[model samples]
Target chain A: MNLYYRGYLLGDVRRFPHWSEPSDAAGAEDAALADETIVYLRDDFSVVRSPVGADQGVLWDAMTPQWREFCDTVLRFRPPRESADGPA
Target chain B: MDRPDLGEQERGQAVGLPYIVQGGGENLADRLAEDRAAIRDRLRTDGAVLLRGFDVGGTDGFAEAVRALSGELLPYEERSSPRETIKGRVYSSTEYPPHEEIFFHNENSYQQSWPMTLYFHCVQPPAAHGATPLVDTRRVLAAIDPAVVQEFSRRRWMVVRNFHPDFGLPWQQVFGVADRAEVLKLCGDRDIDAEWRSPDQLRTTSIRDAVHVHPDTGEPVWFNHIAVFHMSTLSADLRDGLRELFPEPDLPANSYYGDGGVIPDDVLAHVRDCYRSAATRFDYRRDDVLVIDNMLTAHGREPFSPPRRVAVAMAEPTDAGARP
Candidate 1:
């Protein structure tokens, strides 16, 4: 299976900030050039984008060390996810 | 310190200390009225009242008794709004020296609504000074000019809640109504405006120019644009500018009216003089519970020696607009 690690950029994401499926490679390229490009890592972990998106979870899992470091460095105050027991 | 005088003790609680009722089989209404006639009358006529001897005895006993009584009268949620201290939910007067010449006004007057009744139980009354002076707003209204009353009734007034940094994040976020939409919704057809601003190191949201009438009596009240606009603590410039605009109708310093604005200076001076002239002094004895109508009367304490303790509980209307 050919996997394309694609994501959104900071600027483009601002217009449509809510979570959504990734656009095609051409659109991603346009967003990249527009400076709205976020970081995107391929299946092999080579390509890097300028901005990041929520859809990069799969790419993040593949590069555990880099992903952990990036999260610790950038997103300092992310709240813990709710447990299966549900909200209090 | 004088030994507990048995003679004074047997005469009921000594002067200036809280006393407890073991269990008096009296109808609540009758008891409230009979024991607190001065306060009730003040409430009916003035919109506020105070009883001095409601709480007396040892500090712990007074606090516990008040807490229990308050729990019965008010719900848990309502009780949460009270100021807490090491002694109890209600801060004792002993912690802070009472302000002398404390002017007449409602408690938390800046809010959209305020407590309908306020009760102060005297744990210890000052040996000298510390007499709670009372005033009735109805008398004030009756005393003022009919033309002035008519004009105020017709006009909408403004209220601005200046945000204070001391409120911290949680308080700042949830200080007033839940949100702007809530305020608009609650205001309904009333002609009003609101602005959120940062002033004096506090983020504040001010509601401008709203009209309100007394819910029960349907009396045309001057609700709006007094404490928040003209009070010295809020904005001196706004108050001064307002005075300049309505020079003849300037609000008096250190005083407020039920109409939700500053009582006019001339009227204020007259009322102040009347209060001063009619002032009466009394001391507190233990086991007395004094209740007053929050809206009908204004209350103030005379200065006193330290270690004076008092517990307070405020009663409010179940209906949102009935009292504030």
Candidate 2:
């Protein structure tokens, strides 16, 4: 189960055995960034990266404490819009 | 067996897979307060996210969840698929037969203005194979051959639509206007080229970019309904039957180059291949919610078995105009 505090997903709290991390993939850097790792979060509370130069970062476990804290502090949850249709 | 508090951690299997957050019987109000910013950032970066096991059980719960995300609600105007408005900002999902597979396309991408965000609430998941498959548009752009992408970008694309009361959706239903003057005014506002074949029949064409860049991230994404709208999507038998009824130009819907040239079959085939290879899918559970940035991702439906009902809500309308 993913635990989120104030819309920020808290990491290092769980493990996902079924997911296979992609290998040595590199997307063209976002036009706004230069020489920075393109980091994204995976479903299992793990952080992932596209390879940088020759460095293929470790999978699911390389998320640093600082990154985790940043996500925890900055992420916000958005709920569904209110509707009269009521719950299903 | 594991305790429920441990959380079900099901990871996706691709580079652009959606991140899933499972609920632990907590009220959605509490969940929204915990991470609205994280959810937004992930959506901007990841394209799609799923929330399962939450209290979003019915139309009210679904609407409440959507409201918590953003109060901005977009109108479902200029629709292509058949859907009925259920309540305030909530509508039934596409009403296609269960046996048919809906091809991948961005919601309302054919229109000049479309909802920036989309939410899907699953009331009852099918007993078998009712998965709403998603593909990250960024990944799709990356996967397609650069040469083909460049050619499409240069040529742009034009969608041709003919609304006939005898077949498909009539102009009245499509534009939601009964009077011709109102329909003409609406079309004029959006730069749609409209012509009247008869008092009730109408044909329209709109040219749009085959690719679009996200406003927030500046990431280029594949954003068009070219493959789905093209004649190639129809089986030969269906195509022949349709041709017997109307000329190629008078088909319910079709696509071509903005300059009125033919788009080759091989090009569309290449695009379909990319979508198939890049798609990531997961089964929908009752009360699950899937949120997506409309321009950042594309969505489609797979053939399902029984008892599937999904409701949709859209918000944050953005006008792409003639460009991204």
Tens-digit lDDT track of model 1 for A15-68: 322323334433544542333234333434333331123233331233456443
Docking class of 1: incorrect
- Cα lDDT computed for each candidate against the true fold: 0.37, 0.69
- Model 2 residue runs over 4 Å out of place are A1-88, B1-16, B321-324
- Lowest-scoring 10 consecutive residues by lDDT in candidate 2 chain A? A1-10
| lDDT value, residue B278 of candidate 2 | 47
True-vs-predicted CA distance for residue B300, candidate 1, Å: 2.4
Candidate 2: tens digits of C-alpha lDDT, residues B13-114: 123346666677677755765678877777776677787777875788777777777665677888887887888879988888787678889998888888
Shift of residue B96 alpha carbon in model 1, Å? 6.0
Provide the TM-score for each candidate, comma-separated: 0.45, 0.74
lDDT of 2 at A1: 22
